[model samples]
Target: MWALRRAYNPLKRRGFCIGTSRACGAKSELGSCHLDEKASVGEAAQVIADRSLSLKRFYSTTGDSSKFFMGRRSFSSQAGAKSSGEVDDDLEDGFSELESPASAEAILESNAEDENEDELISEPEPSEGDDEDAAVEEPQNELELSDTETDVTEKRSPRKGVPSALFKAIVAAPGLSVHNVLDKWVEEGNDLTRAEISLAMLNLRKRRMYGRALQLSEWLESTKRLDFVERDYASRLDLIAKIRGLHTAEKYIEKIPKSLRGEVIYRTLLANCVSINNVKKAEEVFNKMKDLEFSITPFACNQLLLLYKRFDKKKIADVLLLMEKENVKPSLFTYRILIDTKGQSNDITGMDQIVETMKAEGIEPDINTQAVLAKHYVAGGLKEKAEAVLKEMEGGNLNGNRWACQALLPLYAGLGKADEVGRVWKVCESNPRFDECMAAIEAWGKLNKIEAAEAVFDRMLKTAKKLSSKHYSALLKVYINHKMLVKGKDLVKRMADSGCKIGPLTWDALVKLYVEAGELEKADSILQKAVQQSQMRPMFCSYMVIMDQYTNRGDIHNSEKMFHRMRQAGYMSRLRPFQSLIQAYINAKAPAYGIRERMKADNVFPNKALAGQLAQVDAFRRTAVSDLLD
Candidate 1:
């Protein structure tokens, strides 16, 4: 009646359900024990005992345990005295059948006797090598290995080097397999604890071997027998993240218990969606985890910024919509990506709204932020606004920021603001790694402020101890533009003396300046030397300057020779030079000289327009004669 009552009870059925009884040979319940043929109670109890003992040992070996026995107290107490004795008999019978209880008892008893073993094993062991390589205390959840396992097993001898107390404690541990594996890992040169083991698995995942990493993580989970099932399942979920195979990774993730689903894995799937630029897929993944209120770490959320920054603008709206739906707060980098991309494309309209979004989100822009705005101002040709932004940056102590400074310098130079350029230079003087100084000096030269530029130039020269061609060329232009022609010439002499190869532009500037200043002799000398040093013909500008010099000095003879040479050299369409030549010839009062005799007998005479002008000159001679007659 009691077995019938217990069998019929729904709550008891779960625990009592078992295989077919031997006599019935078909499935039957405990209530049928009174039938003519049945297996004795003793035999039924034996199977239960055998299963319980095996499960207990298995759970003890690995670190897992279950609570199936917790709610069975009422059933155990209600059973008859005979059933009670049978249960105890079954427990002993299962233990004896598997292994000697004495040995198991001895293992358990010895550990309990030496309570000091707990204290010893609880302390951290040192690593191999000297004091320098000794292990440091790890963070919570970090794995640590035993010294004896790592050190003693290698020599197949006791490691006295390890403090005796720690070694003995490790040897005395009841779970021998646990002790051995820990020691073996140490012997194989790993001295990691559980927390460290997890970290190592994380490191392996970073190396892209997801399969191998998952196996290692599963092994760790099995061994640690983690009390928190979520932690184990989360780790396993992370390991399958890189599988590209069809549904393999997803299938594995689904196997994880509902309570164990990890946010990182969901985020990773979301990231994959973003990677393929599939915003819809990403939304689906996010929505599934929405009820869990899965919040991503800063590192994971940052990947969204990268994806948006790489893809075209069309995808940005979709990505933003997904983020909005998920309530995923965009990081500072997200705003930065938008600002930078928009700034680069010169899409100022987008930038305005982005800035407002950043402000509303309370994301403060850094130097990068200001630099992007500065770029927008530059590309749109808003020089004044660009300068204002740069000036505001300086007021905020950002002048030394290299990107902002580089952007600011060129803007000032473009506007020809020597005073502002000078101001930037003065501010740069205090710092050793000054980038603005050279740009500022070049700006000063462009403004024709040689004195102010020279002051900085000299300081940089003395302080820098070396000068590049850019510095030399800038200084040369300043000297020439300010009418310091002699000083400019001296610089050329110095370049020649120091074996520096002066380029054609610098030589052209020097020669043009001398010719402009009425120093034809100096100009000719420099031109001849430049030809020899450069081993190349002088520029057309050089020939033009020489021709102009001769024409201005009324040397029509030499001027015509150079003009013919220039025309032969293919510089023929020079109208102003031809006019200068005509003026020079008229001024020399050589109209009677045959045009053929003057221009190498080629009959290239002055045009018919000049014939009338020549007639006036002849009439002046006749008027002089008539005046004498009068």
Candidate 2:
């Protein structure tokens, strides 16, 4: 329907894949007005300003708020990895979806990696002082525990900058309140600066120390030694969403000073919604953003684009139409998303046209583009075209473009070019990055070169200081595909011996490995253990594995259990589990009674294939012999 609408739109003359059949309209107290092709960005912005007239009167601009609009857009463009919810849930749920991955907490908690590790980062103490307005004097009272502070780092704060030493002390003093830690630093005569505090939090965030990062933010807000900016509030709001949940984050928004709440803040909420794959919530937030008269940035648009790209692609045109109306420029991320969307529909011609338009806009395609292009080309069986793109990517000095090398390994392997994988990997082998090593292992595994994959894994173990569970999962994937259950188990042990944190990926790997070994019960048992042990819920993929196995055997009870467990784990937005449940019912030749009602509740509409099957099953709905006897 979106594509059809796009066809008749006036923008058809521009040859864009995106268009609006109706004139773009904005709502404001002044009344509705149509934005046409003649509408300049300046005019659109003026309309936005007028729309927010009431809020503007209450909270005047300091100019920084504008940065969040343009700044977030510019930043997202360069974040090729954010394309991953193409995977962070990247591009974690990257730029963490590409973790190859919130709600904000979902993405943040995910960005933080495995919830068990999150337990290491101290939750900020609930204090009257935590209310940004309240400034109680005694730090000890603010953190009212019988303070036998067990220092994580086991070192005293050195006589350095308070912010700098504070970072070190917090790392050393996990489980201790950050407010207390800051109190200790202040007592030792160290002064603090906002920049230093910002830098330290950046480090914590970079290392996935979201718990610690969150604690620091709370302490900063309580201290009130520094002024709070819109960005500061936005950052704290996002951290809360990450460590806490969206509900908590939403509550915190009201607590923020009215002037400090704006697009950046709501954008954070929208991103978390997208990360969670909540079509309903995300749309609510996006509409809320518009109603509040915020100029929709590419970050916001891209988040929506990413969301639709995953769940409801028909809505992407609506978003693009909104962007065009808003005069919001498309970033490389935007173009990349559009290209992928077209490719996903197998529209080769449409895809290339977008690429040409992107080039005409003077935006040079990067490694991520080539990677996506190769994938689409290969999927369309354009082997020669895919290879040509790969060749161009490999052109000139491969040494400068390490991204191309990383993208190449997997791309080459997909084409069954084992030798080409080797050639690119040989370049990486000289001084290996962790990701390159991961890619190399995956490539060899795809080629069924198990020994080579093992050698790469071994090299990583020796050279990479310490590897995370994800690193081990790469090799584990190879073993699982080859049905080498023994090796997979051995790798899990090695992971534990290395003191690696077991996250969803490891749990998924273990499930697949066991299931592939014809030990369905073991896989089910493993999922149970994961539910019990992991602070991070096991991925729905693991549940699907066990569910699929049970469905195959017509073990309806077990399949239903898996389905219920998946919803309990907060993975209800996806349709895959629902399909698995229905398939199980079908295999059992029983009507999937009340399934349509359940689907409606969950907002999952069956496609034509599923709908037809559901109709068949619904017609056969009857009380079974066992139920009648009962």
Query: Which is the leading candidate under TM-score?
Result: 2
Candidate 2 Cα misplacement greater than 4 A, ranges = 1-20, 23-166, 189-191, 620-630
Residues 584-612, model 1: lDDT tens digits: 66666655344334433432233233333
What lDDT, from 0 to 1, does candidate 1 have?
0.44
Report every candidate's CA lDDT. 0.44, 0.60
Q: Give the per-residue lDDT digits (tens) of candidate 2, residues 180-253.
A: 88778888988678656765764454344567777888887887866877767877876676667779989999
- Residue 197 of model 2 has an lDDT of 72
> How big is the positional error of residue 622 in model 1, measured in Å on the Cα after superposition?
87
Model 2 CA lDDT for position 475: 85
